[model samples]
Target: MSIAAIPTIKLELALQSPWMANQVAITRNNRLFLGLPRYSAEFSTPSLARQAADGSLQPFPGNSWNTWKPGDDGREAFVYLNSVHVFNDETVWCVDQGSLSAGVFGEQYSKPAPGAQKIVQLDAKNGAILRILRFDDHILPPGAQLNDLRFHGSLMYVSDSGLGGIIVHDLENGKTIRRLSGLSVVKASDKAPPAMLAHVKGGTTFHPPNSDMIEITADGKWLYWAAPTGPLYRVETRILRDMTRSDAEVASQVEAVYDNNFSGGCAMDSEGNVYFSETVTHNITVWSPTGKTAVLVSDPRLVRPDGSFISQDRKLYIPVKQPVNTVTANGKSEQRFNIYSINLPRHLDGIDLGRAITGV
Candidate 1:
């Protein structure tokens, strides 16, 4: 079914910070989870603050949700985490860049120990650290940084957008694979510009280093990836999981699945439809196997739509930032941002592709 128009209703989810909003995810129970990558300080906590089934918003204590166990001294922190995935009702894993002074840690005097990039697996229900998979010694180079991640079953695939490329991790074996270090994928006609091309306040541009978004097929056979400043690429799960291949050999096989330069994060629904923020045009684009490319939303109000999620109710929940015009729902335009819940003109009834299929 082709959607002629998307019905987006703007809610007043006014953001309190100006950091780069990354990704968002909605649980089956309507619990809303979001991520902020470049903020003032590491958000040491996480929770579902959305309105509950009873129509009441519940605010869990900051220390009660996603967090890190402090260093020896309570003041020394351990959280430059960015993206998170809530799975299996209780498991929640978050990516910690390890470089404590990066992102939200900017200019803060908190010193960080060398080699900190790691993924923390937490019990969402209890906020307890189930396991800490540090990658600095495994995947990242001496000065590189780890950014976002997505999980499937026992394996977690991460994107090292900082030093460029993707990192494949084996949770059970504590093994790591760093594929396509500096160049994600090379092509003869690839000339897409970076997604973060606009300048915001304080003369800041959204230029990131490497792959920024990663998604896995429901049955876990394919991994879709893209960078905020590079080409969109993907690889088969079998190649990624092979414990015998050399990094250079794996790089030789990495394929460019999509060439669109998605300036923002990419969202994939149950039906395998890929949605990406076309920052260059202030629009959202959806790509499907039918070889169809359609603009899902193009409202001027959708300035810099970043981390986004599609709910069971078929709603596209997006966290918007740095509006070109600062106008509210009422026509007053100024510079402001908010997290919006938009209703898709089409339902996701056909999104389930059943058992994931392999991708080139």
Candidate 2:
């Protein structure tokens, strides 16, 4: 079938804030939430926060869960929280990497506080606690840098960027399994990360997190994922959920489907088309369910499109974090961030991402 003509998408600045953010979760009711990995944080910085009607960023539920200083017992709050999702439009799901936090200069590869690493679910309407899922040492390495989250049926998937692999958690059985661990395909490619991450050089230590961003098709059968410096890869959900399958069996199921990568974040539409936010080039590329790829959007103002969301109302929301521009490279004295939204092409549909997200 021939592709539709590219629409003249209007890029609108939705909001601007003082903090840098990478990922965003939008509820069906239109609540906006954003997340960021703790980079150069101060005492009041929140890894996860909500944007209010007044345009202020509030620490998600409250200050308690968001607070974590170096020596403070981080067991109860977000230690290195990053990824967030509005699952089923009814609840909020957050993945706490539970490990490294911002050090004096940059992100530190340190041991996670006890009981800090976990996946927490909350009631979307009231921000009430729903459930918390924890992982064992065997599944998560001591230096595990958990990155992103995706759901298909009863399974919740997380990527361990610090290491290399996909973590699968069964909601029904409360069991967790690891797949594609230590595989080169999931590990960070030697090629430099695009956008602001590429600015580091000469004495600045840098490492690209592996198996970081992921997206699932509407049917929940295939998962497309990649590292920061990437060529996207895909694997069947069945191979990942089967407890009987060995790690090697799951790894064998992976296939490299796209080459032009290096994205900081990614999202999928109901038709199984995956949208990649190329941080380096400030472009959004979409790969169809059938494996064809195309440039969806290219806006120079989208400086380091860190994380994105495709709302139910047919809009692609992007957060321009401007990582290197504000932090160290460009040497800016003041720093602020902006979020943008573009209209999504109208479609009849294929899969309901909602049902895929909840596995209902």
Candidate 3:
């Protein structure tokens, strides 16, 4: 379907409810999950929220999971949500980094408690937390800034953007290892748009995170990612999944793939096409699996599009926010703080492709 085919009236209604969200996801049944990271929120907010087709928002999983206060024990609640995912259509995985910025460590952002900095995995049907995956200081470090994640078989790959590394965790064996930390590719290249570089408060801040967003191909062969200020890179999933591989072995498999200039959030379709939200250009572009690039959508309302999701119906849902608009524009981004979506081609949604396709 063409982008213009999206109803004008519905798009207008979607624009009416403006909320700054870091990420957005859609379930097989069409449920919308919004990741509203708390560290940057100016008002009281739900770190993870669920929005219905009628435009109502509610604390996802439950209110208890979203009501953690400053001094409260955060083990049962969310500290700061950087990314949220609907795993295999029946589960939700919420990535809580436990801090204001992922790169600044040893601050109070370690989730308010020892085990608080973890992934909250819950059953989508009952809203019951099925399990929690905790990363100790040795594995996660304090305020390691777990940015985003991709699942492969019995393993999961998490981006430690804060400290510069990709954490490979084994769900079945419970072994976690941080790889590619020594590679400059996993760290911020300090190549953010020169226009935003002059901003007094922006991406150039001391704690610039590395290896920010993550994506897994449809065949689970390659994993692509980069810092928010980026040049997309990829590595073999087999190397990351093999828990026995040494750090050097895994690092050797890394490859600099696409030159995805400073981008916000991204998502991959089952056909291996990746849709990147161009933060600097304020546009949406797609990189085909075969290494070609093209602009998919362009709009003034797409200011700083962050983490996005491609629905089973092939609609790319995006959340727009402009954290540095104070220097970028007067109030362009603030006015359009909305969850916008563009209709895509017949490509399948990655996460909703099939059950255990990676041989869980």
Candidate 4:
């Protein structure tokens, strides 16, 4: 569809924080939360923080929760927080990648530190930590990174961008299952073109072992995920949550949904409309329930748009990280990273899994 045919969306500046953020979460009351990944030592800000109106980063929940020393247990602190999701129950979930970039190339990062990989749930109303879920070393490889996650009932599915799979967490038993491990569909494509960023040199290619994005259906029945260079895929949540099913059995249940270019992050509205960013094209596209795809917004300023959040009021918030430039320059770059929001149509407001399941 032509750009002029799409609905006119006014890009609203939400927060202009000093530290670059990978993702954002908006609470029911409209509070803003930001996740700052430790891409390099230059990013010394709190891993997970609340963005104030003045663009200051406040240590979320508390200061001690954000502080981590070299010898300290990384599980207790916010170690390389990647994404944050605010649920309908007023709880905020945060994913910690548990490692730092050590080698010269972007793909050759360091191993995760001891007790580094985990998911923490915080009470949104009072900023209190409700629970912490740690992954075992055997299941979560040292190179494995938890990218993004979505909820379905009491279970949470997290995309492992580093190892190319999905980590299914059962809240009831605190047990974890790894699905689609080493699968070609979940892995980043070597043949796909490199991601283009305005300030990066020769563009940034898709590093192997990455499946960085994920989203759940409104009915909490299916999950959709993709790599940067994607043919988006989905699997029935019932197959994932079934403990009796073998890994091979579950893998067979996965199905391809749609082919897409290099996409960064995605979200699904109440109407089952899926929204995702095309990093190379600098535009946002929406896939309706009827299987039609159209550009939502396209602009030169959308440089490397990463994780996005659709708030309760029907506003889509995107974080423009320009990660290619940051990685190519080895984090020694200066770029003003900001959160931008565009108000979606009113019909898209209530189609999230949380509301659909609860009928609230």
Candidate 5:
């Protein structure tokens, strides 16, 4: 499943004024939206949350007092919003980590806020609030934060890096289960050459939220997930759909399988090859069932490729955020981010990623 080296044309979708654009997804109408994690300037202005009635993004609203504070004070009071996914092309869910705003010292010190985070779903076309989901369903340890997610029909699977687990929700029945709590199979030092912990830019070290990233197969039968800090894990939709499955049963199956360091947002081609973003190398790698490695794209311009999607035509659309030149080892860095599309040679035709030993 290898293709010739294709030249990538990088475009700056939104520059630094927006600050730390995380994951992105294309709407049904083909409108592109990127999640802006609350950074100093973005939170300071509430500009990140604002959207016009006509579907254009506007400034985010003010805090409780109607006074807009860009970001939270140097405390655990606020979190930066990171990833967002479009479920039905019309409904979108956004995740926020309240404590990331406090640890902006370039990774020297960081802490999770003593608060339960949330996932907000909004109407992409009308800017209406569909729902806001959060949970106290299960107990969690101190260092936990809700990360990326995916939806199939009426079910939603979310990663909790803070608690080091995955949360599954049946949108139809409102049934929720937090699976694999405190179970992060991928440790920080698992990869060769040591995957970098630095931010998209440079010098800022980023520890594995342990939650990493995830993507469900097109048919919603299997889920391919991995921690940015460790190995990849997957599970069947039947197991996740079975509320009766014991945690141990789920854990046992979870342990059976593991794969590469799929750090960035993931996508599947029509032929079933899993395209993963390797933050450490700044390239996109394809993983096929045959265990063949194909370099989809390898260029310094990509910086950090996050959330991605494949159109029906097999064209790959990746929203790359925070492009930086020199990492911490190289000293000083520059920021360049954008949402771009590339043509792919194959289509995603539903490939079964098999079973896994570890639970998601």
Candidate 6:
């Protein structure tokens, strides 16, 4: 069933610190989790936080977890929290990209500190740190920015936006493998023009350097990904899990799924419908299982929808960060950040695809 028009409802407003919200994760019980990355000097908020009933930003777990000093270990504190993923098992996984800022305005943006790049798993109920996984320098280089991630069974696939490629991690053995490094599909398109937002004074370029958005099918069979300025592509998870396959062989298995404009984030529902936030167009586009693309929602206020979350109740939550506008405004971002939610149709609701298929 194709949705003709979806109405967006304003969920929350970030009046305290505008233009700092990045990602939103809603638990099964309807708890909201927000991630704030320290992108500019204007915003000095917690890297990872949760929204209280009164709409206040409380540091997740504790204040020490969000505090970062010069000599602190990046593994212990939240250096630069990028994305947060809450799974069906009631565990929250936070992705620390390590980079201080996106380096959009200038090269002086801070770089990733030691022990900064890692994934932390937390208990969703009480926000307790369950486990932490750090990648080696060889697998995940110092300059590599670990972007979004998706899970299929015991394996987790992470996108390296700074360094073009995908890093596969084994949850059981803690081994990692990097695939399709420097590949054209995984890297941002040089031919594609820069993305411009309407609210910003001057348009800012959005060359993500590598793949930044990713999504897995409900059945856990296919993994789809794309660079911020490149076309969509997907490959079978079986091939990605096959350790015997060579990089060339794995690259051959990747198939171009869709040719789209520059986008910020992408997600997939249980019904096999894919959603993409087209920052240049200021709209969210949906691609159905039968290979049809349609605009789900379009609004001028959606200035760079960075990360999206679909709750079990079929509500799509999107955090409007407006990164381009913030950078173009020279860190004096006047626009207010907000989290919007739109109820999706029953046919488009998200399910535990991994659990449904594997019966875990």
Q: Looking at candidate 6, what is the lDDT of residue 49?
A: 70
* Candidate 4 displacement at residue 313 in angstroms: 0.5
lDDT per residue for candidate 4 within 177-285, as digits (tens), equals: 8887777768876546633322242234325437788888767877888887777888888887687987678878888777776777777776666778777788887
Model 5: per-residue lDDT, tens digit, 175-222?
Answer: 887777775442333453334543443334455566557767667777
lDDT of each: 0.57, 0.73, 0.69, 0.72, 0.57, 0.72
1-360: candidate 1 lDDT, tens digit per residue: 453434453333533322344555566566655554434343333322333456443432245333443342212223455665655544556676644432334433233355345666655444466777665544677545676776677677777766666777766777777776766452212344533445342334434556677777766777777776546566787886676876677766777666664456667765567778766676776766454556666666666677676666677777775533355688875443366665665543333222211211
In terms of lDDT, model 1 sits at 0.57
Candidate 5 global CA lDDT score: 0.57
* TM-scores of all candidate predictions against the true structure: 0.73, 0.86, 0.83, 0.84, 0.74, 0.84
Best by lDDT: 2
Residues 120-180 of candidate 6: C-alpha lDDT, one tens digit per residue: 9998778888988888788886667888888877888899888788988888888899888
Could you tell me the TM-score of candidate 6?
Answer: 0.84
Model 3 score (lDDT): 0.69
Q: In model 1, what lDDT does residue 257 have?
A: 62
Task: Compute the lDDT of residue 49 as modeled in candidate 4.
Answer: 76
Angstrom error of the Cα, residue 223, model 3: value is 1.4
